[model samples]
Target: MAGLFATLAIRKALDKLSSILPAISLLASSSSAAAMVRQGHEQDLEDLRMLERTMHRIHATLKDAEQHWDIRDESAKLRLKGAQGASV
Candidate 1:
């Protein structure tokens, strides 16, 4: 009779564990998915930062070119005016 009682107790514990197993599995999967999403977001932020830096460098280069062109245009105009005055 004692052996039968031990068997019955073990079976009851197994039954309870079986009922709880699905909930544990679901929690584990959800945690894993959340970690993956967080990692993806971090990677995207890093890419955006790199893109912003590249754009800033490009803007600076364009500004420098514009300044150079403006100086050249002014020099050409001065030369044209000087030649006209001499010819007159």
Candidate 2:
């Protein structure tokens, strides 16, 4: 169904987001902001702020997905294959 595909797309996006979050978080802290300012990298600080906002939005989407998503074996395997291909 259309709804299922949309759910799958959201799941795929979340998987991608999850994989990248740690790297983003490492660069998004208050200390990191201060370092960027001291180094005169205002753009980098702004980028970190953007990443934090993006992560918050994704987290909210994830909560919604948890409530509404239907996980079936077939779809899960498909998502796994897609992730594996992306890693290559």
Candidate 3:
């Protein structure tokens, strides 16, 4: 549950970054390492990096969700079987 929330938060942040990054690049102009990164319309580069990270995180989250779903399905199936046997 906590992991899901963290993954969702990161996903939301990445989405916002994608939308606002072009404007951010236009506003960024300086010679320092951080500032230089902002000068060359390189927000796309940052966005790409963020996307890669997000993809990795989302993949992990999906795997976890699938596993959880499988377990829940198995449990439900067992309960249904027990109920059917009792009815019989």
Candidate 4:
């Protein structure tokens, strides 16, 4: 799931970059073109950073869930063993 999110984020960034490309060409000789490119690059970097943070959070959540699941399984097994012993 985190991989899926990361892939989607990359696709979105690429889409944004493609859209910006034509505009950059239109203003190729203008000083503002450099500024625009710089700003766009900075925005993309920020977006990627945000995506990385989000992925980290998602990974942590998944790890926590898996740990809880393991604990639950162990508890269930112990209960089952105790119940069988009592029956015997």
Better of 1 and 2 by lDDT: 2
Clashing pairs in model 2, backbone N/Cα/C closer than 3 A: none
Model 1 off-target regions past 4 Å?
1-33, 70-88
* Candidate 4: stretches off by over 4 Å: 1-33, 70-88
Q: lDDT per model, in order?
A: 0.47, 0.53, 0.53, 0.50
Q: 33, model 1: CA deviation in Å? A: 6.9
lDDT of 3 by residue, 11-67 (tens): 566677567655665555433556555545466656666775765566465445535
Candidates in descending lDDT order? 2, 3, 4, 1
Q: Give the distance in Å from residue 40's predicted Cα in candidate 1 to where it truly belongs.
A: 0.4
TM-score of 4: 0.43
lDDT string for model 2 (1-88, tens) is 4334544665576577657766655555534446646455445656656655665564455445445555466685565445334432
C-alpha RMSD in Å of predicted model 1 compared with the true structure: 34.4
Indicate the TM-score of model 3.
0.35
What lDDT does candidate 3 reach at residue 66?
39
TM-score to true structure, per model: 0.41, 0.39, 0.35, 0.43
Query: Order of all candidates by TM-score, from best down to worst?
Result: 4, 1, 2, 3
